[model samples]
Target: MAEERLIIPKKISNRFLMMIGLGLVLLVAGIVLMMIAGPAHHDAHGAAAATGHHATTWYERFLANLWLNNVYFTGIAIVGVFFTAVQYVAYAGWSVLIKRVLEGLGYYLPVGGVIMLLVFLLPIIFTGHNPLFHWTDHSLYEIDGPNYDPIIAGKSGFLNIPFYTIRLVLYFASWIFFAWWLRKQSVAEDLNGGLTFYDKSIRISAMFLVVFGVTSSLSAWDWVLSIDTHWFSTMFGWYVFASWFITGLAATTLTVIILKQNGYLKMVNANHLHDLGKFTFAFSIFWTYIWFSQFMLIWYANMPEEVTYFRERMGGYEDHYTWILFTNLFVNFVFPFLVLMTRDAKRQMIMLKLVCVVVLFGHWLDFYLMIMPGTLRGDSGFGLIELGTALTFLGIFLNRFTKGLTEASLVPVNHPFLEESIHHHV
Candidate 1:
């Protein structure tokens, strides 16, 4: 008998590469458009210097804002891919069936790194002050500066540009290194078919999880929470974690179902779907709990600083703020809670996939709500730029993820828990 060959399918890689190239092109084009539009200050002050309908440049500002928001949202999805990989490594589950799907997703980490680097460097590169991060205002640290915010000044040490850039580099480096190592080990198992590969993964995973937790928390603080420099929450780290965790699981479930439907991973049956659905269901509730806890605590305390966050969201943008709260609660909590609570729904591919899609979009909106209100401010209507950017990233992600699935054997035949995973129920 001849040994089986383990070659990755070429078509999948080609398709993925093409989509990735398209996404990069769009991302770069969007950035250029934003740069051309210049800062909001120029538009406001130079209105008299323009002509005709282009005089106000309202359309240009709108496009710039939309593209910028899309950039941030797509960046979140990129983070989602990274988060999924971390969880897989941490659990060391027999997710061999979809491990390549995750590895494919991992490819986006470097892309995400580029996006993040662009965002972080944009202020300096373009000489445009970052509205999202007040600490970036170097003049504020100067002795005679008049535009300095006291709060930002107080935190200058931790939030300085150099420190911020260093932390971000470290975070991206750690994630990329760990993701690459784990993928290498998993693929090596296919060639070696020995317990040594599994042992290596186990040790690395244990160490990686500890590092992952710390870095993830800091990254969330640096990336998201710091947007509102005045507001601080001890639970903010866990709050962001819960959102990403649920989103990552939802994405993973969606990928699995899509592959299974296409006849790629036949070994993953309803039982596997059921297990994935359960995680989606449980995490929905958990996310709601953290959300409410954060909201309720702030509401009850009613401190000026704390309540200001919600007040800006709920009072200033009442319609969107209300809609976001309702949609997040319903799609992430209510719908999934009702649908996935049942044994039949969990086993039903259609229903499970439906729930997964809802959860994924819900969390995307959740991040949107968290970000846009603070960043885009008054002109935050969802439009073509947002949708286009999302489609661009989704197309790229799916292309990469599917190719990864076809790269390796759908099932890890040598995995110790491969049979257990196939038999997973409830």
Candidate 2:
């Protein structure tokens, strides 16, 4: 089994590569559709637009969708490393067999970093305008300039491009470095077969947790929260993390199930699935708690500043967001809670996959609500651009992820937990 896994079956590896071709075709088709449809397409969604913000154009809508996926998938990729760090520091044995899966997922960090950088940097380079983050527009800080905004200018110290870029680079560099170091140590442990690598990994994991705890929140602020420019939430960072964690958990769980269905991870079984299921179920509630807490606090206070975020989504973008808002709650919270409630259900692959797919797409909509309302200024346009961008990201992510799986032996033979994991019973 170890010998076989050392080289992934072509069946699985090629399957993901095929997604790349399919994704490219769809992406090109989408762009062509946009060009033919012209800017008039989005004007219909004007169909409606917000009062205080600039009108959204078609390509800007394309860029907004691009940025949306960048943040959404980046979180899923980072949480892979976060999950691995938690298992190591907590001395978790049950996850040993699936650690490679987590690592494979984390491998996307470097690529995701590049995509995020492009989304942020390209518009500024070509047009000197920040299509995504309104605060990033330099004119907003031009004290005497007509476009000057005192509120946005006040945030200039932290939101300035140089500082923001530095933080963005800092986050990806830190995440990528730890992800590489941990994977290196894991492979080393597999070769040497000893406690030395394991002990070293725990120390590395502890350091990483500290780094991640700080960066996760700050990155969320820089990437998502800053988009609003005016609204702030004390729990926004945590809210983003919760959403990222569950989406990653679902992706990880779904990958394991897929691998098992394809005859990989022979050592993993129902007990492991249950554990993953419990993680998905618990975090759904946790995310709902964060969602409600953020909402309730704002709604209760009805303060203009804090309430503006929700107001923009519910009151202003109500036409497009209303159904999506309810769907987000049902799929992310209500569905997961009730469906995964039974012990047997958690152990069942069919049920887990259903919930995982729903959670994955549900949170994408969650991020859509976060980004589109602000960027499009109430004109919510969902079409080929959104679908195409998402498909391209999905294909690229899966391709990178599956290729990583082939790099290491799926089973961590030298792991101290290997024996226990093989016999692991819930």
Candidate 3:
């Protein structure tokens, strides 16, 4: 079979842009409402001001959910580069057919990194509102102050504003640098068609994996886990990593399937879908393993500090977030485990797509559970902030990923394994 260039239809392109427009409208609207909802003000007693009005409650929830979606989407993009790097390092041939899709998805990291820096970090540090990071309230570090938090202060050396800001910058800079370099070399290979860039990619990928292994975990610690400063979990890093990686896999798989359905990537077929399905399935279980391990150990230990995390999540909310819990576990774990367990299921385009969608939303809820408990406590409920923020990032991702596809040949023109990928079959 001969390989041909993939062309995205104008209809699809228009649709993507329209979605982006809608997402922007929603994001702006959500932001306005959040502003109206008001900044979180803690009373002298260290308790959040009793904003008796529902709108004020909406503001806090919106901020938390917005931050959650931003971090979640960023995680997906970061793992996009990680996935591609791993495939390069492993010399994997089967994925060469869909490498462009993965690369396009990876392009959104810089966008997300900027959002985190400008929206989340700058505000926490300069504004000193400290709504997001309680540690940002200098009063907490005061030895005898009403807002004193000895635990957070104990970890102050590492969690201070200056060090935290520097690490955030370094992490994004490193990730963006590696992702840019990898794609640059790959695109150069498409034109030069030699082992020069290919060999370079392998070496960079090897180095990237090592750096990524550490940075990815630390980013999770800083970005997500730190929300509940008192709660600590040794497994938290790996658990979140599994969630982000699997979600990235599902996003990649879905994009590939969508392209194939639209009559592009003619060389890709059931074998490719099956491999993607396997990843989705395998990692869904891996996510479950980490989830259960984290929960079970905390439950077994029954220590006040450790159990506080689950206690807040289970008991903090007015409605008890029990359903979200079930949804996260069932959709992310059980559905994928059962639906994609069969070989035929993995090959079926419809099933694979369905499972991918499930995994994506399930992990979104997972991040929600992780965040809301600490920030909004029992007040967190899914509303415009959740819906609009999700749409906003979803639009940003589609627009960016699609734009990336247009900039390059949808196929890696000079990949040594291109032939093997073309002939790949189960």
In model 1, residue pairs whose N, Cα or C atoms come closer than 3 Å (at least 3 residues apart or on different chains), thus clashing, are: none
Q: Residues 161-273, candidate 2: write the lDDT tens digits.
A: 88988999999999999999999999898898889999999999999999999999999999889999989999999999999999999999999998899888877899999
**Residue pairs clashing, model 3:** 316-378
lDDT of 3 by residue, 1-426 (tens): 243465667887788777767766775675565566564432222234233533235445556766898889888888889998999999999999899888887788888888887766656656675577777788889998998988999999988888987899899999999989999998898888989998999999999999998998999899888888988999988988999999999999998898888888878889989999999999998999999999999999999999988876664444456667777889899999999999999999999999998889889989988887677764565555566678777878887878777778888878999999988988
Best by TM-score: 2
Runs with alpha carbons beyond 4 Å of true place in candidate 2: 1-15, 43-46, 50-54
Better of 2 and 3 by TM-score: 2
What TM-score fits each model?
0.83, 0.95, 0.92
What tens digits encode model 1's per-residue C-alpha lDDT throughout 246-317?
877777788778777766677777877777788888889999999999999999999998987787667554
Off by over 4 Å in 3: 1-6, 9-11, 24-58
Error of 1 at 192 (Å): 0.8
Which runs of model 1 end up more than 4 angstroms from their true locations? Answer: 1-96, 318-320
Model 3 residue 422 lDDT score: 85
- Global Cα lDDT for candidate 1: 0.67
